[model samples]
Target: MIPLAGWLLAGGSLASDPAPTQSDFGGAGLWQTPTARMAEEGELSFTANRTRPYSRYNVTMQPLPWLEGSFRYIAVTNRPYGQPSLSGDQSYKDKSIDLKLRLREESRYLPEIAVGGRDLGGTGHFGSEYFVASKRFGPVDASLGLAWGYMGNRGDISNPFSIFGSRFDRRPGRDELPDTGGEFNSATYFRGAPAFFGGISYRLPSRPLVFKLEYEGNDYRSEPHDNDQAQRFPVNLGVVYRIRPHLDLSVALERGNTAMFGLTLHTNVARRSEPAKVLDPPPAVRESAAGRGADTAQVDWEAVSRALEDNAGIRVSRISRRDAELFVTGEQTRYFYPAKGVGRAARIVGNEVGGDIDWFTWVSTREALPVAETSVELSRFDALLAHDIDLDEFRRGVERNPPLPRREHVLYRADPPRFSGGWSLGYSQNIGGPDAFILYQVSAGYQAEYRFRPDLWWSGALNANLLNNYDKFRYTAPSRLPRVRTLVREYLTDSRITMPQFQLTASRRLGTDWYGLAYAGMLESMYGGVGAEVLYRPFGERWAVGADLNWVRQRGFGQDFSFRDYEVATGHVTGYFDTRYRGINVAVSAGRYLAGDWGATFDVSRVFANGARMGAYATFTNVSSRDFGEGSFDKGIYLSIPFDLLQPRSTVNRARFVWAPLIRDGGARLSKRYTLYTLTEDRDGDLFHDNLDRIAD
Candidate 1:
């Protein structure tokens, strides 16, 4: 019977767990602890829960089918990190990272099984390890688990692994004054007596509510900071109300005395609204080219170029005719899908050129260097557009070929304006540390650009602070390494208005698959630098590689084009891989950092179809954990959300948010403004093929 149950569970014969019916502290569960349930893939949630001495703000994401990760900040009102200073009142706030892995899915006669670690990275004051299983029958769900460390403080049973050695009988205490916080405290994990906990949840019929009851294992007498309290009852009770599809409210009674309240906001990043197109009508397809005449005059070619740019969003550099084929060289902008730009250009060409033109070839170029060429039969294209025919037939005829050698008979060339400017409002923030909980600023900036040619340009930005609280940013972490990034207070408080960036950039395509870029300027908030990068990305390939080099001088606190004495040279060789699994991408960079530390960084992210990207990265340098200061290393999570998701019209703009536990000097990179790989992304055909339906627009 046991073997049969195992086979069923392995095959995932049972329905997946439903959405959270009750809050589990700050995640998905019943009351005080998590269940064996996992959230849906691509789910992003923010949860805030409070009860007496503890309040937790958590950001969680299910980036894969069998994995869940969360970053949390817990504020302990009863304790403070240290005596108050100019940094403002100090509260005992702890930053923790958690993860869970699913082992087996539930079946008709079996429960889902998972293993998890909480407070895995931090001071380890509330660290715990557990293995849990859950199952559902009708409207009721039940879970059971065994826990160790703080969760097993009751010490109800003997040490489970004591048979191996006497050292496994007791958990080791954590470092009380460590320089860093993210080091894994393995010696203290699952090394003590174990305890059991269980819970049950029931859904109410005809109502958007769920009731929960749980038996907690921790006795609360072993809490950190000598802030322990008595637990009158082992059971916890709670209820959750689903206020809307994206919101939930929960309240719980725990320890038979304290009341807990939680609110959760969640959304699926993979789901997005349909494309919001403009009201302009699509270009009309001509039935025949009978009346069109071939005029290779320079004026005629200029008119054709204007038609392509105004109607099709293609900026033409040159146009020529050779025998029965028409060749146009240009760059594509404005459309998310290159196929749409190509299709629109084809229709406009057929409308202007004579019937003798049998083929239309477009040479896609970036920075005046041709990358790829696509050829289409003008006769077949017109037929597909004018009649009811399979669009696939037209797609099959489209050919991606190498660029042809230079043609001699150019009819027209464009010379565009050299200057443009705009104004925008932007915001920046720092969060989650012993320093003030958050330091933020809102500013308005005017940006201007001058183009020397297609491959060279100059850009600058001047900012005025409209609102800020930088005077409150006083705390700085202690570190043995050079203070490459910890002088935030001096930088922000120097001036209310500043010039964050001003640079001149030059870029060019070196070969069919190689691109290069060079720039010099005040690159970012803290430094002015000169850098160059080269990338080799083949069309439609899953992997690419690039290298970069930079020489920089630290900027003065005034942030007005003045340099300090500090100088450094840093660079990296980076590789990128697209897994092709749910839009996951992995990048690894190895090089020297700003503080002269050598290391590698690993980043993984998933980009949804709607252009929303969620990712995390971690850096490990040669510096020891203690020397690296808080966080042990450099790590953070970021989200880039497309503006189109909130706007009524489609746009390519995005807003980015980043959260880091601490800012240190060990593994920091120069923040360059642009890269060649992103500039030439449309050279690949996959993105265009994925959105073929937009070709008409």
Candidate 2:
């Protein structure tokens, strides 16, 4: 099965009923012209296109109904990457970010309208800005747009902004310096002469073919790297072959001279569903209340505890019964969704209790600390077995809140596991850097955890390199700031068999609405630190705030376990918010960085229905662009995919992949192994909203 990963951008239902198609540039458009169209929300695609001297690869995501974002890499085959001695025979590559916003939706009397910018906040290689409108007629989609800069090199129309000042009369030429480009040049935006462009798409009914023609605003009179090519005509023609629902092949003739070929892979994350858990054991049969007897001693607590762990994915901490309610306390381990654990627990307890117990409450815990609890009316649950009530009706009768500090009538205390470990394979890589196209390593690793108690534990990871191509990682960019993150090459090549991280961590419940965490020892591959954090998150609320502080010393290149003389103190005060709409989350952190720089970071992401989070983050500080080197700032994109999606049995573990255009030394944060916010997410009440469908399963 193909893995579907995504990131945020504008989105909406496809225009004109299945009208939007992936353009050669990987956006929704026709050939070289953009249209006011969008992919369905939660849609993502990877596209590669080639035309003459240029080859472009793009990854586009639509996380919202009115936003779209794309990250692209353009390789100019005709130009050298840098001095031949540094990058021999390597083609110059430019990495850029793009965004499109839908300003107006199509209506009976108006065309859909959108505004966007290309190669934004990056090198001016293909920088441009435009606003376009698109409408659909029977079997055809039409789009018209006005653009500035590279896309409008034809200069067919005067700059509309020229009325404001003479500064708008000319577009600043791109700098010829060999420096890496990533800073945003706002002064150059919408400043050049403009041009008008239009295009149309023709789709045959009941067929898998799509035909398109576009009037391009860019002429081949001048090009990036001063490599201009001749054009035979002003218009472009293209065709798309839909080989499968998620795959497309494109062929196009642009500039009447250049032949283009492209491929696109697409998927929608919002509508994904997990396969039925046929292998999981069925819920225990409901019992007759009168037959179980009214005496509590008749209950086999040990047997019931084992059943909960085996059948409901919950590891029991303790069990107790009040006048009419039974409370089971533990952490969910097997079900990726906590609600599923709750549902299964309800079924298992129904078979153990009788007429005496009228309600069931599960106190969910993490690190043996109670975070939240859910109470369910047994009568409502029993009705589901009799088909007299639906899951939604039963859900309405349930109640949940923060865990209260009290214990009574304790029946059983579970024996917690003391030791756990696992073996796995790992792969890491560096890409799109000017020095080399890719530098990678593969290894076999083992991770183990030993819990002294439920609230305290020691853990470590040891890895042995199996394969790597770090020989090509010879260049290290000079940094005026401390080398906090740029020494990645030295760490990777220092040792073959090494333990990069070894730490001891502990967590505690400070109060009903607060949590505390602390850790010490070897923290990560680059540094060793001791840190503590406190979080104040209300029970079942949508927002939280936290603060953390740490003191760290750089690690030796031996990579096994050694410290360097360099040390610093760093931390952040972070705020987290959940919009409660489409799982959109926004996070901001401000404080001192690893390099002793003051800055703040902004992260925005969307959590899909399938336990996947797609997000991007950017960090800026007082460090100047010249001192920060390439990238001008710190930024990257990441996708965290739930383990359950790749296997039959459910597991909450996730595999994360990160991509950064360049690794710099500024805006670096301490890599804390565990965070209180994530540890207590199950208490936020989103668990039920995200996993409500599992209630009846």
Q: Model 2: runs farther than 4 Å from truth?
A: 1-19, 176-180, 278-295
The candidate scoring highest on TM-score is 2
lDDT (Cα, tens digit) per residue for candidate 2, span 164-209: 9999998888863336578777777898898888899999899889
Tens digits of lDDT, candidate 1, 97-200: 78789999999999999998888876688888888999988889899988887777787888878999987898877643363677778877788897898899
TM-score against native, each model: 0.89, 0.95
Stretches of candidate 1 above 4 Å error? 1-25, 159-167, 176-179, 274-312, 319-332, 337-395, 399-411, 683-686
Instruction: Indicate the TM-score of model 2.
Output: 0.95
**Model 2 lDDT on a 0 to 1 scale:** 0.82
What local distance difference test score does each model get?
Answer: 0.77, 0.82
